[model samples]
Target: MPKAYSYLRFSTPEQAEGDSYRRQMAAALDWCKRKGVELDDKLRFHDLGKSGYTGANFTEGALGRFVDAVQAGEIERGSYLLIESWDRFSRQNAMTSTARLFDLATAGITVVTVDDGQEYSQERLTGPDVSPMLLLVVKLSQAHLESARKSNNVGKAWADKRERARAGEHKLTKRAPEWLSLEDGRFIERADRVEIVRRVFRETIDGYGRRTIVHRLNEEGIPNFRAGENRKRKPTGWHASSVAKILTNRAVIGDFFPGTGSTRFRTYQKEAEPIRGYYPAILDEDTYWRAQAVIASRRRVTDDDGRVVQRGAAGRRGSGVSHLLTGLGRCSICHGPMHIINKGPLPRGGLYFECDTARRRAGCDNMNRWRVDEIERRLLKHLTYIDADAILRGEASHGEFEKVESVKARLADAEKRRKNRAAMLEAVEDMDPDSLARYRELVADVTALKAELAGAEKALAQTAADPGLKARLAEAVDLNRAMGEAEGEERTAIRVRLAEQLRQLVEMVDFHPELSIIAHLKPRADVPADQVPFTYDSGNWRLELSSDSEPHGIDPDIFPEEDPDAVRAANAFFLKRRLAKAGGAS
Candidate 1:
């Protein structure tokens, strides 16, 4: 006796819940039993939820594998290929789909269509009769045409929905971020989940990497929010990739992307232009971008193969090591990395930061050994908050403030012009060609200005939300407090987080041969690299203006005019006497 193989397929997964799956399986089994052929139950081929019109079944699905086996001599030559109909195999192009059916028949395998009870064997197909081949072509052509009409209808329906969504008459999708819920056709932030999202962003802004944040979340046993509430299995713990996606997702800032590709029968789609203010914002744009800046600061520049080609000072922030400053420390003489060297034990021997160049005898000779614990302690205490008061007093928001005011002025002017134009038009009994043209021109101008103003205001909000400077300082303060309270491994973790935060503030720590450590602080926390070097000398216990030959006081322009007293105090913190650098007063 010959063997029979059943190949079943359906376009959408929803069809499995309908009569498609059961009907096709029953037809295949019934036909095989009646013909007295052994059904190959071990090698069942079913392309569930796969599209036939796109030829996905014949390309990547199980149907393709079945055909390949038949052609490769894995299946017997007299074997039967059972399907519900010709459409169940493929609704692709007429010529291509017909070729697939005949290809199996020519390979000595009989193709059986159970619905119409038609069999296309090598003998019958290559016989003198033209009706069988003509019928196959006609059936496949009709299927292709039917699929094309249905595809067009669906595309148009989605286009209408998108247009309506843009007009605020409809919502584009029911799917939303895990932190938000789709209620009454609108997305609302879930308070509990929203807090978790906020914490992730805060941790990132505080110099905690994605892995660190994921570890903390998992250790705390926070219920990891995921999609598909009806899923059988849920994530037991947080993942680094999931945490990274949450940090980078624009949906947190109320952005909705409608995607560029056709999503009707597809699972994944490419993101197109974003629809702003689509959801109730869980995070301000500033907090979102600040977190992005922090992430970018720690990200090492990698090559095509993900090999680290260049690394910033903060690139080694979350290496799970006890070294406080690995990438940030540089030898003053050779400008090489200061690597930590362990001697013997705890009390008798401690970890020391040795210049890698001198230790390895590579290029330059500058031997300066600084105790790791002492360097970490003094740097955390003195350097972390060196320019905290100045930053928190609102100096960074100046540039963005001016931008908002400028946009507001232009917006007001546009509004006034629009009102004047409307009044003039209403006063006229009959509008002339010139008057109509002028009215249209003013309307466009006012609309463009309004849009500009909205963007300017959003940028201003992000500026006011400067999580970079103020957040870093607040994080350092908390870390300092936590270090005093924490012990053992927890203290070490806190030290790593503090070092990451310091990397955002302090650009470099140079250890000279004379036992004088120079701490070079950056102009701003948000910037990863800067040419302007603000130095704090351990020998003098004071902050210097720059590396220039002449030293000057703090710039007056940075201070807001409303609070002169606060400005004077901030100036005093910088110019006044302070603790020495990591090595202490020389």
Candidate 2:
């Protein structure tokens, strides 16, 4: 009696949940009973939740492992391998699996499929009988063509749905649960969880840091969703990353892009593309932007050792240092980072900045550095001068601040338009296909409009609150002048003001006795000189020009005294001579 191993597979979730597997198993067992084949109970393999539509080159879960075992001669010769049909065992594009099956037939295994009523004998398998091969080839070709057609249909449907969404005529396939609902149709927010979400966003945007927010939330008895209800095996508490994700999610801002078909259908298993959202926003656009800007500024902050100061970590200690210069500084010589360095004790250390490239790379002659205090002083002077002049010229009037209000109004308008489009799309979800297509076209138009609106709003907001631009034309010019002149606590206030405006420009500062000081400036298009004030002297040679001396030609034999290499050699020779004299004296 030949031993038989039954293999079964289903392509989709619907098929798995249906009678597909049972039907395949019953047919295979009936064939085994008629053929007088004794099947091994242990070797019966069934792959549920696995797709046969995947090409032959890809492995089919447990089926792949079983095949590997058979190829390794784990099963005795003349064993029967029974499956429901070629399609159930493999798909059309899987040429490799078909070839492997042929090889199994040659190895004295009887390959049989109950659905097709076909049997592969050793003589037919070894002799290359073209009929079975042709049958498989044709079936596979059909499968491949069918698969392509299905894919095209799905893509078209999704495209049409996206269009309808844009036109205010389509409804989302999966509605938000009772806890959630469409706000104007673009954002996903829970009425019950709105306060929690808002708090999370607020903490993150206000620079409280994600981890701190998580801790605060936990401390307030606001447990993890599962834990709050006192459920057994409660989920872990909220994390910083989760808070950060919420802060950045466009879903909160009332946008929905249709996920790509490959993800929607399990065909390619690739990442989905995010389409323009056609839904109501939970958070206002300005609020979303505020969070983003804060996040960006936080990312740019670094500690005295030049390492990034991550969120939830203790912020860098300083009298006044902004978080907007974290990773932007570069060495003038080697184009490496110019990090912050403190020369004294903790908290009160005199801070200086220098380029890491000059310290590491050989032959990098540039030595850039600057004292933090001195740099800040100069920056303040320049800012104060600019501010005072603007005030005197009446440039720092109420008119400038009115732009902020104008931008706020524009933001509100764009948001209103977005919501209206979302509502329109939701109203026509059950329309006819032709009407749906037209609706989708309209949705696409709205999508484009919303995108433009978003861009305009963002630009306007940036311009309104631009510290750099606003500083050069401040409405509080007199106050700025007074603050600039103020000392101690007053100076600290001015420092904060200047810090907010100039934080993005100054990245870091490093100081060394040999290299002096270096300052790393931001790569703004307007600011040309990124390297800060510093002096360089490499023991024997200094990069200083003699203002009073004239250049003269010297003979190579009569070397210049200040030549670094020559000086080193002379010192070495003198040291050796002194050693000889000491030996004689001894």
Candidate 3:
């Protein structure tokens, strides 16, 4: 008996939950049973949510695979291809759909529309029966026309909605940012989600990196806003990318853009310009821009000669901050990054920070190394005791915005120059060599100035939005306390947080040839210039040892009343039993 393969396709995924799947499958099975052919249950072809009108089912879907298999002889020539209707195979243009049908028939594969019970075999298609071929052409053409009309109507509907939204008639669909909800045709902030959004921005502006924010959110058991919405898989906990999206979304500052894509895919191929003040504001403009600037700064750090001193893969900072000072310290001799090199394992063989150049054996023989555990502990302890409010914020001057003002001035000057050049060109009536050169120079200057202005403004906004040095130091002190109390993976996460904080706070850590480290702190808007670079050295700072080094416990009693051999055997037996129990529990 010949095998019959059933092909089912639905233009939308929602139809899978309806009767389309069952109706099509049942028709195919019934046709196979009546015709005395075996239905091949193993090879199931389903193209869910793929558009037949766009020929997606043929080009990028399972139908295409089936056709290829038939042509390659992997599927036997005399088998049958079963579909509920011709439209289920394709709603494409008549010529294309006709060619597809004839190709399958010519290859000795019978095309069966189970709904109409039409068997379009090779003999029927190639024989002198004009009615069969004309009927197929008519059906395909009708399907194509119907799909085209529907696509047009849907596109127009969405376009009208976008226009109405622009005119402020109503909110653009029920979908809003994860922090918002739709109610009464307007968007309202969800309290819990809005708080999470605020926390993401606050932490970012406070110099906590995205990974640190992810760790903190997951540790606190905050529900992920998108967890329930994803249909493809089970919910994953908070991720760094999710935190980054929250921090950078312009929707938080009330900006919205409506766009359109292909009728089938629904992704944005053409996005309209953003409409300012469209959504309800969740964060101030300053906070949003500051988060952007801080996120940019954390991406990469460059040295004085314009060489990138620290960067991880995929244009992102390494999520793993294993060493306390990874990406924070540099070689005093060559100005290269310092990294931790492990000698072997624990107590005797330890980890030490080695200069990158020295480690590569390229140049700069600064063989001095600092033991990781001792330095980290000492540095953390010193950070906890510092009087940040008195030293950093008390007499601080607010000059960060001056940079923005300077950039604006330069941009204005460039625009004036461009306008004057245009006036001169109009007066001249003909383009000379110097005039053309001057016009080009003016255009170049304006373009460069505009880019610089954007950067300056963003940096200034970030500076203004930041919570200042005092707050950051207080956070560091708290983190230190937490880290001191935490162990295992929790301790590692705290270290990552501290490392990100230190990278933002401290300008550079210089490992000298004298076996000492000098940390130069970055200047802040709230700190006085005379009080900075806030230079400090390991030699000047001393680590105060903690007295609670060990837990209180009594010494073991050596004397026993039972026979020594029997006692030893019983103790060994119980120890083995306890070990077995522990393994089982794990």
TM-scores, one per candidate: 0.64, 0.54, 0.61
lDDT of 2 by residue, 1-586 (tens): 5588887776566776779877877887788788788778887677765656664323747667666777797888888778776666666465755676777777777778788778776776556578876776777667666766887898789878876876678765565422256566544656667778777765554345566577678777775544556567666888766776677666666565554534434543311223344545567765676555545655545599976543222344344333223343455455556566667763556665566666565556456555555544433322311233322342323333323333444344445545554565578766556545544655565566566556654554445444343233232334445655777744544443344334433444333434333433333322112111122222111111122211111123433333535533433343355456547868
lDDT values, one for every candidate: 0.68, 0.53, 0.67
Which 10-residue window of candidate 2 scores lowest in summed lDDT? 538-547
Tell me, by lDDT, which candidate is best.
1
Alpha carbon deviation, residue 35, candidate 1 (Å): 3.0
Q: lDDT by residue for model 3 over 199-226, one digit each (tens)?
A: 8887665445677778778888887987
Runs in model 1 with CA error above 4 Å?
12-19, 211-242, 260-266, 304-307, 312-323, 326-346, 352-370, 374-498, 505-531, 534-586
**Which tens-of-lDDT digit does each residue in 1-586 have in candidate 1?**
4699998886667776678888998998899878888899888898866778888887888999998898788898999999898878888989898788778888888999999989989899889999998998899898899989988898779868866775678888788888888889877778989999999987676556677778788888788886446778866688888988898788898877664344665655533335568777888766776666666666557699975443464433343556656566778798777888888788979889899889988887787687887776656544423333323231233456445544555455457756776777789899867457757877887788788767876775565444343233333344556667877766655555555556556666778876566666555422222112234333222333222312223344633334545444543444333222322545
TM-score of candidate 3 to 2 decimals: 0.61
Candidate 3 segments whose C-alpha is farther than 4 A from its true place: 215-242, 259-272, 300-310, 313-325, 328-337, 341-351, 355-586
Give the C-alpha miss distance for residue 91 in model 3, angstroms: 1.5
- Return the lDDT, model 3, position 33: 87
